[model samples]
Target chain A: MPEEVILQAQRELPDWDGQGFSLLETPFSGVKFKRLLGRTRDTLRELLKIPDHFHILFMHGGASAQFSLVPLNLLGDSKCAAYVDSGYWSRKAIHEAHRYCQVEHAAIAEDYIHTSTNTAYCHITSNETADGLQLSLALKASTPLIVDMTSDFLVRPIDFEPIGLIYAGAQKNIGPAGLTIVIVRDDLLGRAHALTPTVLNYTYQVEAGSLVNTPLTYSIYLANLVFQWIGHQGGITSMAKRSQTRSAMIYDVIDASEGFYRCDIPPDQRSRMNLCFKLPDEPLTQLFIDHAAWSGLVNLKGHVQKGGIRASLYNAMPDAGVVALADFMHRFRKQYADL
Target chain B: MPEEVILQAQRELPDWDGQGFSLLETPFSGVKFKRLLGRTRDTLRELLKIPDHFHILFMHGGASAQFSLVPLNLLGDSKCAAYVDSGYWSRKAIHEAHRYCQVEHAAIAEDYIHTSTNTAYCHITSNETADGLQLSLALKASTPLIVDMTSDFLVRPIDFEPIGLIYAGAQKNIGPAGLTIVIVRDDLLGRAHALTPTVLNYTYQVEAGSLVNTPLTYSIYLANLVFQWIGHQGGITSMAKRSQTRSAMIYDVIDASEGFYRCDIPPDQRSRMNLCFKLPDEPLTQLFIDHAAWSGLVNLKGHVQKGGIRASLYNAMPDAGVVALADFMHRFRKQYADL
Candidate 1:
């Protein structure tokens, strides 16, 4: 992610044409900013193996902003779009979509419970960050797909076809916050509602080379750096393997908890990013979190809706960090036995 | 600008928030990653005297982006806008507005010459870079007004009641090149066309306190440092005086040239920021520029539309730099006899 940002900055800096000022500085035409766009776009196309028909746009407003932007851009009329209620994050996306479009659910697994009822965009969160739910049945028969892979983007490239658009804020595995990286088919860019801001209008940014105004150059630069970092990690193939290894260590401990700890998500549909667990009850969970913080393990508190705790092992989380966390969990169970 | 970029990076730097894992190493948000917003919004707000009624939004894109944004936010189909076209920059703003609304020429001089419209909301460059045209009109006006003070924002503080909004690019007197500072009245926000991008929706940003997304933190931090510099220079009051003194010496030579040299703009309307002049015809002008380059003068070319030498004496352009140009100009005017 870091390298991706630096590369983008480098492309614009020193002025691509050897012009005295950069594209960001000069009022030149789109031709100058075009080279930088071509590089980032082509790189994503190859990495995602994106079909030739799609167009990629790096947009503003994080995923939080995207909730309104996506529905405003993609949802036409109140037609119910199919949204698989995966967890807290997916639910939030749905709540926002409801303001602009109707949503039908293909599957829902919010708190260990799973249900299916297929209906607008076959929308789903690839991995739920708050509740640690990963969708298992993904191949859809006939529906335009909109996947919110904010948590798992680039860890493994998407293979199942006919996906309409995939959007992710650049704060996670992609880059940093403030930028939502959108991969829309060329057709999707122009399908926005009439009320979208020119800056958020995928079609406008597409035509304008994202120079509608002085862009968040520094943040975009940061995201570009992250892309470079992801590429250096041998791209998505390697990212998937590392993610699996990190999740397995903690999953092993949970499976061996001997009833001292418990997890909710079904085994077939487990997440590699966020691992949520409960320590018997409220008091015990609080005590363990306290001890963990003293040990420099922080932000271990679970989402308020999901009591217990969640350990987020993102791509940047060194394998050693996960190992240490798993070891802490093991020691915590032992301490309870002593008590 | 630098702080925003740095802190935003720190927040996404994995283990940020002491989370066992951060989203940055993976993908950005919607994917559920949170990047830094910056240390404090008030740090920027307090420096600008931005009225509390208006929410401060740090936006992406440059002042050019604002060309489309201003019309979207401030003028609807029913409302007519009048622009005082003093030079090329105002004409550009008028061109962008033409796409959205009926812009009227409230006043414009013959041959794009420099003079005071001195009317309400008379949109002018305040400090023109390409032609070195500056208006000596008083800031107070009977009608609401907007000014693209891109070249000399914060160079001085006027009472500001008569001004509706002021937009400035950070490259010149403000800071670096990537950020654009827009100080608009509370009522003018969110008044744009409904179809504008949410990114360009100043109303949305003003409401969000500019944290609508990760802004160009680095460039904005640099802008903040510039504000501090202004503060150190006894605010804009002292800045206006210093610029006046520095520019007087140069303009004095041209105004009193006795046909040796010439400037298109009226002496009263001459710019203190950028000063333009010529030595009779094309031959002598080219020769003067060539000799001046060897003497350390650079970027003195005039706008292609208005051919003459232009010196941008921005806030960063020290008094010494101007004296150097003046000395070189005087020597060049005298050194060649026959030409």
Candidate 2:
């Protein structure tokens, strides 16, 4: 959502790179598109600092699809995979993995922690968007590690040595919604089940250069623009620093609110990307949401299942936006403190 | 590809519906996104004249994924599925189907003729984009019929009564590449194999409102604009007429060229969307492609497997483009006649 990226896309909507036709008008297999695809992959590789041994796959179906794909691809001879049920997204991954193989919940909830196991692989949700929980542990497992970094991918730099696979839906830190970025170690390519769909097979996808079919060309193009934007913003290191500064602003407000606003998760497990909190009651929460919306701040409502309020501090969210939210929260508490 | 749609999208890229955020900046599960999703589906339903009994699914992974999905979903108790090997896409569909069930090649190549079979379903590529072959036969089968309408999905009206399911990747006549439109009869739901991935399962997709995960929101939004564009162009009947007229212009040029150019597919089975033909040799073909590119008519190169020229005349392609192509072809033949 960077202004430059949006303006570039708008300017190139009818014609791409002076090509006389839009990017959407190009054939997926054409030389021009192949170059675009290569440029996109190269830019992403540079941005993520992906090791040469890892295959960066541009796939569809979002990170939700990877919940099944991970098990289907990595759970070859083993009958079970170890999973840490941190919160909402981890639970969804666990549920989906059950269709492919038996999943062992190594730990659950606030007490959830990853441990080495004899299972095929260990899966963890790096950040849970719904419950505002995140795995900040220095996770070590005997088996390969699969991380669903849907909410906080590329928000910070991490060591790729211990991770066998990393998948993220590109809606949050990455780019758009439809595209899924799967970074898999080359050693794990041909381990998919025989019945796994061809498009979902890591080996086939890598061989096809993610052009197994006409890929989400426009989405990938937008993702490339996002990658460039990230580069301009000093890459992941700068993004991480900004993320901490922004999240701390609102968390500081919540901490000093004198029981007015409460964040349930322990500080160590709280997600920097999505902060979820509660007011005293449902009516108060509704009023908080309405007031926020009236002040031109929208999408601040909490997940219906877990009522309260939630604020997403993604990489694209500016520090000023977070400061505004903090200021509004302080004002609202003063206005309703006597109630 | 319409100017109005692209301009509207460009205008809305920075702020959507007067909201102080871009559509890409909105949460997929938010109310604004839900409304956008509903509007897209409603527009598609109105454009395609989809029946109430059909569950329209907006999915990812494109038409190639459905090559595996159809067999995985519909081939429950039946060990075999009937498939007409029309051309490139049908063969790919069959190859994928072989992973799930025994595929009975009802017919192959020019001998392809649809017949009733006691299998799970009869699959066919309605228009083969590569070989420029199409199934013009009024297909009837004892089992359900699954059609891959990738290239020419909405080029003409289709009868929904006999067809059990219809899937089209959105890159062609629809919109962009990330989205796939699946129109499934209600009875086809809940019949998927237990091992089928949740995202690929029709029942799950329908139940989830195609929000099983964050879908290709931007692609779906563009597709909705394309549907509106089609409606403004007098709907499918008008589109069919235009397609015929445009394709006829090119076919007429080929017919009058004597031996200079040739289209092999029989007239009845030729695809109106993709017009494929060959010049005398590789050099001539290369020359033709270069000349076409010089004239701002790019992406006219044929599929490498089919070693010829293919001009895709999708619904978005205007009449003037086709006329220009025909005029160019005539001039190229005249200029190269001596060689």
Candidate 3:
């Protein structure tokens, strides 16, 4: 019940009565943005145990932007940067890295499609949204690690020491589909490539306190609101517990099914946030998507290669929403048992 | 009356009975952006007689962003780019250009306390918001010209051939903030330095139809609404007449003040949109600002200069607002005529 409190916070968001402002442009610097950002720092620090030497920056562009930025700032005399090709985003990161410095894949997780690589900065997606894989421990690499944790932020704790940098686009589980939250070490702030745009140079924003060129002010405001929501639900320990149960509930349904439904992910590699699975056939998957849509469950269509379904249980998605989805899957399975 | 009818069109802008789906984000295919952009093109073409050879782009990051971009794409491999320093913005353009190539100033209009000078690009503000100065025409630049016509858009029919590139930060006169309307010749776009970030690359944006990434969707929506608003009011010609009348009314008061007000800049170089003037001392200016705030006429304080008052009358500021300010100025002048 305490875990369900976050949904209440999300619903009561923006607090229009007191906010003196709407979720419009310019910082509701008056109240909303500052309070929420303060709450974000507090909640994140409390949950993730961020230390004095570290900083969490709210920025625009996607993880794609950081690809070039990381090398521009981090790569010194070394001409080559490195990464692991987990999915679309990692490949995208490597493509951008090539534009700045040489890029190489240290390793690639073939079976699970999770990246296993080593290089200047070993990169991987902690939770693969498309492939439905989430790694609990740090993916070991000889080089400094840069992980894209866009889908699994705050769902679990992060090890700050081994990781040189971590960037998460705030869409999948962080917040809305804009703001990017980056946690980088203090030393990494200013070592930008001389050619880097002042706007993209992390230190420029850091020195300016992220008010660099007006920002995605509203998105940060919303993200701050969401961080507060997470804190209100007893922070990350509670969130991890709830998310574990949430992931288990859906994965259990997949496991219990006698081939009536199917999930391609090996049980060990299943994601705590995204549960990607499939129906008996392509036609059945489409039908299931339509059935789910009419019932107020949307965005259920799986990725094109992995057809079936993907249910992303982010912080905002309540346990009840998961239960409702599980219940719908059950009834639909019975309805089409003949298949 | 026709003007009033067109102003009323802004109130009915959403088309969905205020539901707001009409102005949703333009998607990747840019079908929606193209349709609205097509409408904008056809309307502007009819109104301004814009040649088909020139290109229009709807982009993110306003003229401040373009100030650097225009030079990057224009200077090519040239050692020096000439500038016309007029006010706060022209100086900014010169600074941004210095990052890329050597910059030469043809004019420092404000260095002589807003006196005119000969500068290449003759980069005038057309309307300066901070100092409230608007140049009626390009100040005779022999080389290709780039103008930051942000605060005054379409005040008159511009002979685009005379201007190589015209960029506007939309918030002031065109629409809401975050969108920049860049009208550049087709040849000007493709010459960006290899290091230019694709977002800031004018050539990339124009080639891609300005739907590069998920732009500031809401800002562009507001800009399209403003373009439609201008279209309904007999296009730019009508806006020019009304705006000219508004500026003339304020200038008339300043000219008649009998030494109570000291207008800056020579009469020949005076801006029609922004009539910059100063009071005898700081106390009177502070009092005017304080009084203006109390009367709900905000943003009138002079930008951190010694001390003065600046009133920015963009397209959104109704004529009645100017009249009210003019009326206040008349009262203030008469009451303190002894000063």
Candidate 4:
């Protein structure tokens, strides 16, 4: 979603790297496609510092698909899995896992979250986009820790030492929406249930080198561009710092408003990717959103279920945009506080 | 894949339709995205002449994913489904369906293909890409006819009266690889298995208007462009005629080669989309492919399982390409006849 990435993609749209054809026109086995696949995998590995024991797979169907695939692939003879009830996405994962195996709702605050020795894995939605909550607690689980880092994947550096698998939908911090990145430990490859579809089978995908079927070729190409852009922008450490600065700018305005605006999330649990807040009344909230749109700051509406305002500050959001939003929030609060 | 379509896409890559955001940057619920979704669905319906009783749902994953979903969504209370084993892709669909329900292999040549009154559906892969075989028979089935029209979709007009559902991966004729289009009858919406993943559930997807989870934003946008392009190119009627003319130009050389070239598929079953043929020997076949590549005709190598040359003439292929290929084939045959 970076401007440089989008520009590069547009420039190479008609003909990719002078290959005489677009990326979609070339066969997956061709040189251009092979280079794309290899470079994307390598770049992701270099960026994430993923262990050699882990296989990075480019898959389809986004994070929602992984809700079923995680339980199917990891529930090898185990009858149950432990899941942390973080928020919206975590509840969706737990609900989907119930269709495959027993889901034990556990909290990450526990000293050792794994309830039984035979539990399949410990799952958590590391960042909940809907509720603007993120997990910052150190996971103390004995079983494999599976994290859905959909909204906050590359916003910060990851420590793969305590992780078994990580899946992220690429719309937020990575690239686009159609592709899902699954980094799974090699040892957990062939544990899929018999009824698992081959497209969702981890072992088959790894064996086929993630070319089990024609992949989301365009998304992967753009994602590689994004990864390169990230590397150029000083990698995940820089992205994390920017995220903190951007979210704090908006959160500071809410904290200083003195009942003019409010954010209910605890400071420890607030998501740096998506910051949700509310104004005093529905009419004032509407006015704030309308005024923001008039000032060329769009898509500030919150998730419909929550119904207030959300400022999603992904990696692509420039710092100037956040500064503008903070400025707008201050002016809007001054105008509405006297009402 | 059309040059005009690609150029249009490239032109609008940075900012789509003056919305000041790329297609991937817009939220699914936003006005730009909703317009895209509606226009795409409408254009496809107009092109395919899809009935009012059918709901056109844009989905994730490709044809291979649908091999499992078709059965999962339509199996209902029926324990058996009839599948026609034509070739590679059909066998794949049949194999995947076996994991879910009882698969009854029935040929289209049968007078009444459905063996039981309670059979869920009759499935078929309309065109076999690997072997250049296609089903030309008018199917007679008491049950709903579910067709995997992945390769041949939009190449010809379809009769929807006898069909219950049709699904196609959009890469072939529609757009890119990540999005699949599922057109299901209104009556078959709620028949998915209890454990079916929500992403694969037809009822859930329809109710959510294919925004169930992001819905492959970029592919849908490109697919809309392709639909408009198809409309400009005189719709499916023009595509079918061009397919015949283009394939006949290649197949004529094979038939006239006497013993120098051979296409094993029966004349009636030979596909108009993919035309496969073999040279006298492996060396000659290798020479032909290399020469064709040098002449700027690439990707003529056949499937590895079926080692020969396959000329896949999709909708995007210009007639000039076929003319060049036919001319090259004639010259190559004249030169290699002495060998």
How big is the positional error of residue B129 in model 3, measured in Å on the Cα after superposition? 2.4
- In model 4, the Cα lDDT at residue B167 comes to 92
Q: Clashing residue pairs in candidate 3, if any?
A: A106-A118, A107-A116, A107-A117, B106-B118, B106-B119
In angstroms, the error of model 2 at A226 is 1.2
lDDT by residue (B1-339, candidate 2, tens digit) is 666777788788877888777777777787878898898888878877899999888999999999888988888787889988888889999999998988887864453345445587888889999998877636665667788998888788887867899999998888888789999999888788988888888998899999877788888788888988899999988998998889989998998999788999999888898999999999999999999989978778898799889999988777788888999998999999787
iRMS per model, in Å, is 6.9, 1.2, 7.5, 1.1
Which has the better lDDT: candidate 1, or candidate 2? Answer: 2
Error of 3 at A203 (Å): 1.6
Residue-level lDDT of model 1, residues A1-339, one tens digit each, is: 343344444454444356544433443333544455566667777767888676677765566667667776776553567777767988887777776666666654342222223333567788887898776434553556777888888777686465778888666675545566877766666667754555667777767666655554445545555566777879877888998888989989998988787887888678888888888878899998999988877668887787788988777666777888889999999989456
Question: Rank by TM-score, descending?
Answer: 4, 2, 3, 1
CAPRI quality level assigned to candidate 1 from its DockQ score: incorrect
Of the two candidates 3 and 4, the one with more favorable lDDT, higher being better, is 4
Q: lDDT by residue for model 1 over B201-293, one digit each (tens)?
A: 788777765655555544544455556666665766788888898889888878676777788788777888888887788888888878887
Can you give the DockQ of every candidate in the order shown? 0.21, 0.77, 0.16, 0.76
Question: Looking at candidate 3, what is the lDDT of residue B244?
Answer: 76
TM-score of chain A of 1: 0.84
Model 2: lDDT of residue A229: 90
Clashing pairs in 4: none
Prediction 2 global C-alpha lDDT? 0.85
Q: Which ten residues in a row have the lowest lDDT in candidate 2 chain A?
A: A108-117
